[model samples]
Target: MRILCIGDVTSPKGVEHLRQNLWRVRKENGIDFCIVNAENAALITGASVNDAETLLSSGADCLTGGNHTLRNRSVYTYLDDSEYMLRPINFGEGTPGHGYTVLDCNGYKIMVINAMGNINIEPVLDSPYSYIDRVLEREAGKYDFAVLDIHAEATGEKAAIGYAYDGKISVIFGTHTHVPTCDEIILPRGTGYISDIGMCGESGGVLGMNPELVVKAQRSRMPIRFEAASGAPRATGVIFELNESTGKVTSIKRIAF
Candidate 1:
Protein backbone atom coordinates (compact mmCIF):
# COMPACT_ATOMS: atom_id res chain seq x y z
CA MET A 1 0.00 0.00 0.00
CA ARG A 2 1.21 3.50 -0.81
CA ILE A 3 0.15 6.32 1.51
CA LEU A 4 0.86 9.99 0.88
CA CYS A 5 1.01 12.27 3.91
CA ILE A 6 0.90 16.03 3.29
CA GLY A 7 2.17 18.76 5.58
CA ASP A 8 0.37 21.64 7.21
CA VAL A 9 -1.64 23.94 4.98
CA THR A 10 -0.90 27.46 6.18
CA SER A 11 -3.38 29.53 4.17
CA PRO A 12 -6.06 29.72 1.49
CA LYS A 13 -3.28 29.81 -1.06
CA GLY A 14 -2.05 26.50 0.20
CA VAL A 15 -5.54 25.08 0.08
CA GLU A 16 -6.01 26.31 -3.47
CA HIS A 17 -2.70 24.85 -4.48
CA LEU A 18 -3.72 21.47 -3.13
CA ARG A 19 -7.10 21.69 -4.81
CA GLN A 20 -5.34 22.28 -8.09
CA ASN A 21 -2.44 19.86 -7.81
CA LEU A 22 -3.06 17.19 -5.17
CA TRP A 23 -5.17 15.01 -7.42
CA ARG A 24 -2.39 14.84 -9.96
CA VAL A 25 0.21 14.10 -7.31
CA ARG A 26 -1.87 11.28 -5.92
CA LYS A 27 -2.49 9.90 -9.38
CA GLU A 28 1.14 10.02 -10.43
CA ASN A 29 2.31 8.51 -7.17
CA GLY A 30 -0.38 5.83 -7.14
CA ILE A 31 -1.43 6.89 -3.66
CA ASP A 32 -3.79 4.46 -1.97
CA PHE A 33 -4.62 6.79 0.90
CA CYS A 34 -3.84 10.48 1.50
CA ILE A 35 -3.61 12.35 4.79
CA VAL A 36 -3.27 16.11 5.07
CA ASN A 37 -2.61 18.29 8.10
CA ALA A 38 -4.85 21.29 7.72
CA GLU A 39 -5.08 22.99 11.09
CA ASN A 40 -3.66 26.17 9.57
CA ALA A 41 -5.59 26.05 6.31
CA ALA A 42 -7.39 29.32 7.05
CA LEU A 43 -5.82 32.75 6.51
CA ILE A 44 -3.83 32.56 9.71
CA THR A 45 -5.38 29.98 12.03
CA GLY A 46 -7.74 27.02 12.14
CA ALA A 47 -9.36 25.55 9.07
CA SER A 48 -12.92 26.53 8.31
CA VAL A 49 -15.69 24.15 7.22
CA ASN A 50 -15.19 25.22 3.64
CA ASP A 51 -11.46 24.75 3.86
CA ALA A 52 -11.89 21.21 5.19
CA GLU A 53 -14.49 20.41 2.58
CA THR A 54 -12.34 21.78 -0.20
CA LEU A 55 -9.41 19.66 0.88
CA LEU A 56 -11.52 16.53 1.25
CA SER A 57 -13.02 17.02 -2.17
CA SER A 58 -9.60 17.69 -3.64
CA GLY A 59 -8.17 14.29 -2.62
CA ALA A 60 -7.36 14.19 1.10
CA ASP A 61 -8.84 10.96 2.41
CA CYS A 62 -8.30 12.07 5.99
CA LEU A 63 -7.42 15.40 7.65
CA THR A 64 -5.30 15.74 10.77
CA GLY A 65 -4.95 18.82 12.95
CA GLY A 66 -2.73 20.48 15.52
CA ASN A 67 -2.67 23.24 18.22
CA HIS A 68 -4.46 25.80 16.05
CA THR A 69 -7.30 23.43 15.14
CA LEU A 70 -9.61 24.87 17.74
CA ARG A 71 -8.74 28.50 17.12
CA ASN A 72 -11.83 28.96 14.99
CA ARG A 73 -15.14 28.16 16.68
CA SER A 74 -16.96 27.89 13.39
CA VAL A 75 -15.35 24.56 12.55
CA TYR A 76 -16.27 22.87 15.78
CA THR A 77 -19.43 21.39 14.34
CA TYR A 78 -17.79 20.14 11.19
CA LEU A 79 -15.06 18.58 13.23
CA ASP A 80 -17.67 16.69 15.21
CA ASP A 81 -19.61 15.61 12.15
CA SER A 82 -16.74 14.47 9.97
CA GLU A 83 -15.58 10.93 10.61
CA TYR A 84 -12.10 11.47 9.22
CA MET A 85 -11.30 15.00 10.44
CA LEU A 86 -9.37 14.68 13.69
CA ARG A 87 -7.79 16.66 16.51
CA PRO A 88 -5.24 15.45 19.06
CA ILE A 89 -6.27 12.21 20.73
CA ASN A 90 -5.03 13.45 24.08
CA PHE A 91 -7.43 16.38 23.82
CA GLY A 92 -9.54 14.14 26.08
CA GLU A 93 -13.23 13.42 26.21
CA GLY A 94 -15.83 16.00 25.13
CA THR A 95 -13.51 17.43 22.49
CA PRO A 96 -15.16 18.38 19.22
CA GLY A 97 -13.73 15.55 17.09
CA HIS A 98 -11.94 12.28 17.52
CA GLY A 99 -8.20 11.71 17.31
CA TYR A 100 -8.18 8.47 15.35
CA THR A 101 -10.18 6.74 12.66
CA VAL A 102 -10.22 3.41 10.85
CA LEU A 103 -10.85 3.50 7.14
CA ASP A 104 -11.87 0.45 5.16
CA CYS A 105 -10.37 0.72 1.73
CA ASN A 106 -8.87 -1.51 -0.94
CA GLY A 107 -9.68 -4.62 1.07
CA TYR A 108 -7.64 -3.37 3.99
CA LYS A 109 -8.44 -1.69 7.27
CA ILE A 110 -6.13 1.30 7.80
CA MET A 111 -6.00 3.16 11.11
CA VAL A 112 -4.86 6.77 11.25
CA ILE A 113 -4.08 8.46 14.57
CA ASN A 114 -3.54 12.14 15.39
CA ALA A 115 -1.70 13.14 18.55
CA MET A 116 0.03 16.25 19.90
CA GLY A 117 3.18 16.71 21.95
CA ASN A 118 2.98 18.15 25.43
CA ILE A 119 6.31 19.94 25.40
CA ASN A 120 6.27 23.67 24.64
CA ILE A 121 2.57 23.66 23.77
CA GLU A 122 -0.53 25.17 25.32
CA PRO A 123 -3.29 23.50 27.34
CA VAL A 124 -0.96 20.72 28.28
CA LEU A 125 -2.71 17.44 27.56
CA ASP A 126 -2.14 13.88 28.58
CA SER A 127 1.00 12.09 27.58
CA PRO A 128 0.95 11.17 23.90
CA TYR A 129 2.61 7.93 24.87
CA SER A 130 -0.18 6.83 27.18
CA TYR A 131 -2.95 7.93 24.86
CA ILE A 132 -1.57 6.09 21.86
CA ASP A 133 -0.84 3.02 23.96
CA ARG A 134 -4.42 2.92 25.05
CA VAL A 135 -5.75 3.39 21.52
CA LEU A 136 -3.57 0.65 20.06
CA GLU A 137 -4.54 -1.73 22.82
CA ARG A 138 -8.20 -0.97 22.43
CA GLU A 139 -8.14 -1.27 18.65
CA ALA A 140 -5.93 -4.32 18.40
CA GLY A 141 -6.96 -6.98 15.87
CA LYS A 142 -9.41 -4.51 14.35
CA TYR A 143 -7.08 -2.74 11.94
CA ASP A 144 -4.52 -4.11 9.55
CA PHE A 145 -2.11 -1.17 9.56
CA ALA A 146 -1.63 1.98 11.65
CA VAL A 147 -0.19 5.39 10.75
CA LEU A 148 0.44 8.29 13.11
CA ASP A 149 0.61 12.02 12.60
CA ILE A 150 2.31 13.55 15.63
CA HIS A 151 1.63 17.28 15.62
CA ALA A 152 4.47 18.51 17.74
CA GLU A 153 6.91 21.42 18.09
CA ALA A 154 9.85 19.43 19.44
CA THR A 155 11.85 17.29 17.08
CA GLY A 156 13.29 15.21 19.91
CA GLU A 157 9.84 14.42 21.22
CA LYS A 158 8.66 13.35 17.80
CA ALA A 159 11.70 11.19 17.26
CA ALA A 160 11.27 9.54 20.64
CA ILE A 161 7.66 8.67 19.92
CA GLY A 162 8.58 7.36 16.52
CA TYR A 163 11.19 5.03 17.99
CA ALA A 164 8.98 3.97 20.85
CA TYR A 165 6.34 2.71 18.44
CA ASP A 166 8.65 1.67 15.67
CA GLY A 167 7.46 -1.89 15.22
CA LYS A 168 3.88 -1.10 16.10
CA ILE A 169 2.99 1.65 13.65
CA SER A 170 3.45 1.41 9.91
CA VAL A 171 4.28 5.10 9.42
CA ILE A 172 4.97 7.98 11.80
CA PHE A 173 5.24 11.55 10.48
CA GLY A 174 5.59 14.77 12.46
CA THR A 175 3.92 18.14 11.92
CA HIS A 176 3.31 21.60 13.54
CA THR A 177 6.83 23.01 12.88
CA HIS A 178 6.11 23.69 9.19
CA VAL A 179 9.70 23.01 8.16
CA PRO A 180 10.50 19.84 6.25
CA THR A 181 13.32 17.81 7.72
CA CYS A 182 15.90 16.03 5.60
CA ASP A 183 15.81 12.95 7.79
CA GLU A 184 13.34 10.46 6.39
CA ILE A 185 14.00 6.84 7.15
CA ILE A 186 12.46 3.49 7.83
CA LEU A 187 13.28 2.46 11.38
CA PRO A 188 14.97 -0.84 12.20
CA ARG A 189 11.55 -2.21 13.06
CA GLY A 190 10.24 -1.20 9.63
CA THR A 191 8.28 1.92 10.59
CA GLY A 192 8.67 4.98 8.36
CA TYR A 193 9.63 8.18 10.24
CA ILE A 194 10.22 11.85 9.50
CA SER A 195 10.71 14.76 11.88
CA ASP A 196 8.44 17.03 9.83
CA ILE A 197 6.82 17.08 6.41
CA GLY A 198 6.92 20.89 5.99
CA MET A 199 4.09 23.23 5.02
CA CYS A 200 2.00 23.77 1.89
CA GLY A 201 2.32 27.51 1.34
CA GLU A 202 4.69 30.18 0.15
CA SER A 203 8.12 28.56 0.07
CA GLY A 204 9.94 31.86 0.64
CA GLY A 205 8.00 33.03 3.70
CA VAL A 206 8.76 32.49 7.38
CA LEU A 207 6.95 29.21 7.98
CA GLY A 208 4.22 30.37 5.62
CA MET A 209 3.65 33.72 7.33
CA ASN A 210 4.68 36.98 5.70
CA PRO A 211 8.37 37.39 6.46
CA GLU A 212 8.18 41.14 6.92
CA LEU A 213 5.29 40.89 9.37
CA VAL A 214 7.04 38.24 11.39
CA VAL A 215 10.24 40.28 11.47
CA LYS A 216 8.41 43.46 12.49
CA ALA A 217 6.68 41.66 15.31
CA GLN A 218 9.92 40.15 16.58
CA ARG A 219 12.01 43.27 16.20
CA SER A 220 9.40 45.62 17.73
CA ARG A 221 8.54 43.23 20.59
CA MET A 222 4.83 43.74 19.99
CA PRO A 223 1.97 41.56 18.93
CA ILE A 224 1.52 42.01 15.20
CA ARG A 225 -1.07 40.03 13.28
CA PHE A 226 0.77 37.71 10.99
CA GLU A 227 -0.64 37.13 7.54
CA ALA A 228 -0.09 34.37 5.01
CA ALA A 229 2.55 35.31 2.47
CA SER A 230 1.09 36.26 -0.88
CA GLY A 231 2.60 34.35 -3.80
CA ALA A 232 2.60 30.94 -5.41
CA PRO A 233 2.44 28.10 -2.89
CA ARG A 234 4.17 24.75 -2.88
CA ALA A 235 3.18 21.42 -1.38
CA THR A 236 5.57 19.32 0.61
CA GLY A 237 5.24 15.89 2.21
CA VAL A 238 6.30 12.24 2.10
CA ILE A 239 5.08 8.97 0.67
CA PHE A 240 5.43 5.66 2.43
CA GLU A 241 5.25 2.35 0.68
CA LEU A 242 4.15 -0.49 2.92
CA ASN A 243 4.13 -4.22 2.46
CA GLU A 244 0.64 -5.55 2.89
CA SER A 245 1.70 -8.92 4.24
CA THR A 246 4.04 -7.59 6.93
CA GLY A 247 2.21 -4.33 7.63
CA LYS A 248 5.55 -2.51 7.62
CA VAL A 249 6.95 0.22 5.43
CA THR A 250 9.18 -0.96 2.60
CA SER A 251 10.40 2.46 1.48
CA ILE A 252 10.02 6.22 2.02
CA LYS A 253 10.14 9.11 -0.43
CA ARG A 254 9.95 12.89 0.11
CA ILE A 255 7.80 15.02 -2.17
CA ALA A 256 8.07 18.79 -2.73
CA PHE A 257 6.84 20.86 -5.66
Candidate 2:
Protein backbone atom coordinates (compact mmCIF):
# COMPACT_ATOMS: atom_id res chain seq x y z
CA MET A 1 0.00 0.00 0.00
CA ARG A 2 1.15 3.52 -0.78
CA ILE A 3 0.40 6.64 1.24
CA LEU A 4 1.29 10.21 0.31
CA CYS A 5 1.94 12.78 3.03
CA ILE A 6 2.00 16.39 1.82
CA GLY A 7 3.81 19.25 3.50
CA ASP A 8 2.17 22.40 4.77
CA VAL A 9 -0.18 24.21 2.38
CA THR A 10 0.50 27.88 2.90
CA SER A 11 -2.36 29.61 1.12
CA PRO A 12 -5.25 29.36 -1.29
CA LYS A 13 -2.99 28.95 -4.30
CA GLY A 14 -1.18 26.12 -2.58
CA VAL A 15 -4.46 24.39 -1.85
CA GLU A 16 -5.65 25.01 -5.41
CA HIS A 17 -2.47 23.60 -6.84
CA LEU A 18 -2.97 20.48 -4.79
CA ARG A 19 -6.57 20.28 -5.96
CA GLN A 20 -5.44 20.55 -9.57
CA ASN A 21 -2.60 18.05 -9.40
CA LEU A 22 -3.46 15.66 -6.57
CA TRP A 23 -5.60 13.29 -8.66
CA ARG A 24 -2.90 12.88 -11.26
CA VAL A 25 -0.21 12.71 -8.65
CA ARG A 26 -2.03 10.08 -6.67
CA LYS A 27 -2.86 7.99 -9.73
CA GLU A 28 0.59 8.20 -11.26
CA ASN A 29 2.24 7.46 -7.94
CA GLY A 30 -0.14 4.72 -6.89
CA ILE A 31 -1.06 6.52 -3.70
CA ASP A 32 -3.89 4.78 -1.85
CA PHE A 33 -4.11 7.22 1.04
CA CYS A 34 -3.12 10.87 1.52
CA ILE A 35 -2.38 13.16 4.49
CA VAL A 36 -1.91 16.91 4.23
CA ASN A 37 -0.60 19.53 6.63
CA ALA A 38 -2.88 22.50 6.10
CA GLU A 39 -2.27 24.69 9.10
CA ASN A 40 -1.61 27.59 6.79
CA ALA A 41 -4.24 26.78 4.20
CA ALA A 42 -6.03 30.09 4.47
CA LEU A 43 -3.67 32.96 3.70
CA ILE A 44 -0.30 33.58 5.33
CA THR A 45 -1.28 31.39 8.30
CA GLY A 46 -4.15 29.47 9.89
CA ALA A 47 -6.71 27.21 8.28
CA SER A 48 -10.18 27.92 6.94
CA VAL A 49 -13.13 25.60 6.52
CA ASN A 50 -13.32 26.29 2.81
CA ASP A 51 -9.67 25.52 2.21
CA ALA A 52 -9.79 22.38 4.32
CA GLU A 53 -12.90 21.22 2.50
CA THR A 54 -11.25 21.81 -0.86
CA LEU A 55 -8.22 19.81 0.16
CA LEU A 56 -10.34 16.91 1.39
CA SER A 57 -12.68 16.84 -1.59
CA SER A 58 -9.81 17.05 -4.03
CA GLY A 59 -7.74 14.16 -2.68
CA ALA A 60 -6.44 14.35 0.90
CA ASP A 61 -7.92 11.82 3.28
CA CYS A 62 -6.62 13.48 6.47
CA LEU A 63 -5.49 17.00 7.40
CA THR A 64 -2.82 17.88 10.00
CA GLY A 65 -2.28 21.07 11.94
CA GLY A 66 0.40 22.95 13.83
CA ASN A 67 0.81 26.23 15.74
CA HIS A 68 -1.57 27.92 13.37
CA THR A 69 -4.41 25.44 13.72
CA LEU A 70 -6.66 27.76 15.65
CA ARG A 71 -5.89 30.97 13.81
CA ASN A 72 -9.30 30.94 12.26
CA ARG A 73 -11.84 30.32 14.99
CA SER A 74 -14.49 30.04 12.32
CA VAL A 75 -13.23 26.55 11.52
CA TYR A 76 -13.17 25.28 15.10
CA THR A 77 -16.58 23.73 14.71
CA TYR A 78 -15.61 22.10 11.49
CA LEU A 79 -12.42 20.83 13.04
CA ASP A 80 -14.32 19.30 15.90
CA ASP A 81 -16.77 17.57 13.60
CA SER A 82 -14.50 16.43 10.78
CA GLU A 83 -13.17 12.95 11.34
CA TYR A 84 -10.29 13.64 8.96
CA MET A 85 -8.99 16.87 10.46
CA LEU A 86 -6.65 17.05 13.47
CA ARG A 87 -5.06 19.62 15.74
CA PRO A 88 -1.78 19.27 17.59
CA ILE A 89 -2.32 16.69 20.31
CA ASN A 90 -0.51 18.80 22.86
CA PHE A 91 -2.87 21.71 22.60
CA GLY A 92 -4.98 22.68 25.60
CA GLU A 93 -6.58 19.59 27.12
CA GLY A 94 -10.05 20.83 26.30
CA THR A 95 -9.30 22.10 22.82
CA PRO A 96 -11.81 21.25 20.14
CA GLY A 97 -11.07 18.66 17.49
CA HIS A 98 -8.83 15.64 17.73
CA GLY A 99 -5.11 15.12 17.90
CA TYR A 100 -5.18 12.06 15.72
CA THR A 101 -7.66 10.49 13.35
CA VAL A 102 -8.11 7.00 12.00
CA LEU A 103 -9.40 6.87 8.45
CA ASP A 104 -9.95 4.09 5.96
CA CYS A 105 -8.10 3.35 2.74
CA ASN A 106 -9.16 0.33 0.73
CA GLY A 107 -10.64 -1.17 3.91
CA TYR A 108 -7.42 -0.65 5.83
CA LYS A 109 -7.43 1.40 9.00
CA ILE A 110 -4.66 4.02 9.00
CA MET A 111 -4.01 6.19 12.01
CA VAL A 112 -2.59 9.67 11.45
CA ILE A 113 -1.31 11.74 14.34
CA ASN A 114 -0.51 15.45 14.35
CA ALA A 115 1.96 16.79 16.91
CA MET A 116 3.86 20.02 17.38
CA GLY A 117 7.27 20.62 18.91
CA ASN A 118 7.42 23.12 21.73
CA ILE A 119 10.82 24.70 21.08
CA ASN A 120 9.73 28.18 19.98
CA ILE A 121 6.03 27.52 19.42
CA GLU A 122 3.04 28.98 21.23
CA PRO A 123 0.07 28.07 23.48
CA VAL A 124 2.47 26.34 25.88
CA LEU A 125 1.50 22.79 25.18
CA ASP A 126 2.75 19.58 26.70
CA SER A 127 5.80 17.80 25.44
CA PRO A 128 5.18 16.08 22.12
CA TYR A 129 7.30 13.21 23.37
CA SER A 130 4.99 12.39 26.26
CA TYR A 131 1.78 13.08 24.38
CA ILE A 132 2.77 11.01 21.39
CA ASP A 133 3.87 8.21 23.65
CA ARG A 134 0.53 8.23 25.34
CA VAL A 135 -1.24 8.25 22.02
CA LEU A 136 0.78 5.40 20.57
CA GLU A 137 0.36 3.37 23.73
CA ARG A 138 -3.37 3.87 23.71
CA GLU A 139 -3.87 3.36 19.99
CA ALA A 140 -1.61 0.33 19.77
CA GLY A 141 -2.93 -2.64 17.88
CA LYS A 142 -5.88 -0.62 16.67
CA TYR A 143 -4.81 0.24 13.11
CA ASP A 144 -3.13 -1.32 10.14
CA PHE A 145 -0.47 1.39 10.13
CA ALA A 146 0.44 4.64 11.86
CA VAL A 147 1.83 7.87 10.42
CA LEU A 148 2.84 11.03 12.20
CA ASP A 149 3.12 14.60 10.97
CA ILE A 150 5.53 16.30 13.37
CA HIS A 151 4.97 19.99 12.75
CA ALA A 152 8.00 21.65 14.23
CA GLU A 153 10.67 24.33 13.76
CA ALA A 154 13.86 22.67 14.91
CA THR A 155 15.21 19.85 12.82
CA GLY A 156 16.78 18.26 15.87
CA GLU A 157 13.43 18.07 17.58
CA LYS A 158 11.85 16.53 14.53
CA ALA A 159 14.67 14.03 14.20
CA ALA A 160 14.36 13.13 17.84
CA ILE A 161 10.70 12.37 17.40
CA GLY A 162 11.45 10.22 14.38
CA TYR A 163 14.13 8.29 16.19
CA ALA A 164 12.11 7.89 19.35
CA TYR A 165 9.25 6.33 17.46
CA ASP A 166 11.36 4.72 14.77
CA GLY A 167 10.28 1.08 14.94
CA LYS A 168 6.99 1.80 16.61
CA ILE A 169 5.38 3.61 13.71
CA SER A 170 5.17 3.14 9.99
CA VAL A 171 6.22 6.68 9.02
CA ILE A 172 7.16 9.98 10.61
CA PHE A 173 7.09 12.97 8.24
CA GLY A 174 8.07 16.42 9.42
CA THR A 175 6.37 19.75 8.61
CA HIS A 176 6.16 23.45 9.78
CA THR A 177 9.51 24.45 8.34
CA HIS A 178 8.57 25.19 4.75
CA VAL A 179 11.98 24.43 3.29
CA PRO A 180 12.45 20.88 2.10
CA THR A 181 15.32 18.92 3.56
CA CYS A 182 17.30 16.17 1.85
CA ASP A 183 17.34 13.81 4.81
CA GLU A 184 14.67 11.38 3.70
CA ILE A 185 15.60 7.92 4.94
CA ILE A 186 14.18 4.78 6.48
CA LEU A 187 14.98 3.98 10.07
CA PRO A 188 16.73 0.73 11.00
CA ARG A 189 13.40 -0.71 12.02
CA GLY A 190 11.55 0.19 8.80
CA THR A 191 9.99 3.51 9.71
CA GLY A 192 10.09 6.13 6.96
CA TYR A 193 11.40 9.50 8.12
CA ILE A 194 12.13 13.00 6.80
CA SER A 195 13.26 16.13 8.55
CA ASP A 196 10.85 18.27 6.62
CA ILE A 197 8.73 17.62 3.54
CA GLY A 198 8.82 21.34 2.54
CA MET A 199 5.48 22.83 1.58
CA CYS A 200 2.77 23.18 -1.08
CA GLY A 201 2.85 26.81 -2.09
CA GLU A 202 4.65 29.32 -4.33
CA SER A 203 8.21 28.11 -4.68
CA GLY A 204 9.44 31.63 -5.29
CA GLY A 205 8.15 33.07 -2.05
CA VAL A 206 9.68 33.16 1.42
CA LEU A 207 8.08 30.25 3.22
CA GLY A 208 5.10 30.71 0.85
CA MET A 209 4.53 34.35 1.77
CA ASN A 210 5.11 37.24 -0.62
CA PRO A 211 8.84 37.89 -0.63
CA GLU A 212 8.38 41.63 -0.86
CA LEU A 213 6.30 41.70 2.27
CA VAL A 214 8.70 39.46 4.16
CA VAL A 215 11.70 41.44 3.02
CA LYS A 216 10.11 44.73 4.02
CA ALA A 217 9.37 43.39 7.47
CA GLN A 218 12.90 42.13 7.86
CA ARG A 219 14.37 45.38 6.64
CA SER A 220 12.09 47.58 8.72
CA ARG A 221 11.96 45.40 11.84
CA MET A 222 8.24 46.13 12.03
CA PRO A 223 5.04 44.20 11.54
CA ILE A 224 3.83 43.99 7.96
CA ARG A 225 0.91 42.52 6.17
CA PHE A 226 2.52 39.49 4.65
CA GLU A 227 0.45 38.20 1.76
CA ALA A 228 0.50 34.88 0.04
CA ALA A 229 2.71 34.75 -2.99
CA SER A 230 1.24 34.42 -6.47
CA GLY A 231 4.30 32.98 -8.07
CA ALA A 232 4.39 29.44 -9.44
CA PRO A 233 2.83 27.09 -6.92
CA ARG A 234 4.11 23.62 -6.19
CA ALA A 235 3.36 20.68 -3.92
CA THR A 236 6.07 19.00 -1.92
CA GLY A 237 5.85 15.79 0.12
CA VAL A 238 6.91 12.18 0.45
CA ILE A 239 5.28 8.97 -0.67
CA PHE A 240 5.70 5.90 1.47
CA GLU A 241 5.25 2.40 0.20
CA LEU A 242 4.21 0.06 2.98
CA ASN A 243 4.38 -3.68 3.11
CA GLU A 244 0.70 -4.41 3.60
CA SER A 245 1.08 -7.65 5.43
CA THR A 246 3.82 -6.42 7.75
CA GLY A 247 2.51 -2.88 8.10
CA LYS A 248 6.01 -1.49 7.80
CA VAL A 249 7.61 0.91 5.39
CA THR A 250 9.20 -0.74 2.37
CA SER A 251 10.43 2.40 0.63
CA ILE A 252 10.39 6.16 1.07
CA LYS A 253 10.39 8.57 -1.85
CA ARG A 254 10.55 12.34 -1.84
CA ILE A 255 8.13 14.21 -4.11
CA ALA A 256 8.04 17.78 -5.35
CA PHE A 257 6.44 19.66 -8.25
Candidate achieving the largest TM-score: 1
Q: C-alpha displacement of 188 in model 1, angstroms?
A: 1.3
Off by over 4 Å in 1: none
Task: Report RMSD (Å) for each prediction in the order shown.
Answer: 1.0, 1.1
The C-alpha lDDT values of all candidates are 0.93, 0.89
- Model 1 compared with the native: what TM-score? 0.98
- Residues 103-205, candidate 1: write the lDDT tens digits: 9869999999999999998768888999999999999999999999999989999999999999999999999999999899899999999999999987778
TM per model? 0.98, 0.97
Residue-by-residue lDDT tens digits, candidate 2, 61-179: 99999998898899889988999999998887678899998888898889899999988767667788888889888988788889999988889999988899988888999999898
Using lDDT as the measure, the top candidate is 1
55 Cα displacement, candidate 2 (Å):
0.7
Task: Mark the 10 consecutive residues where model 2 has the least summed lDDT.
Answer: 118-127
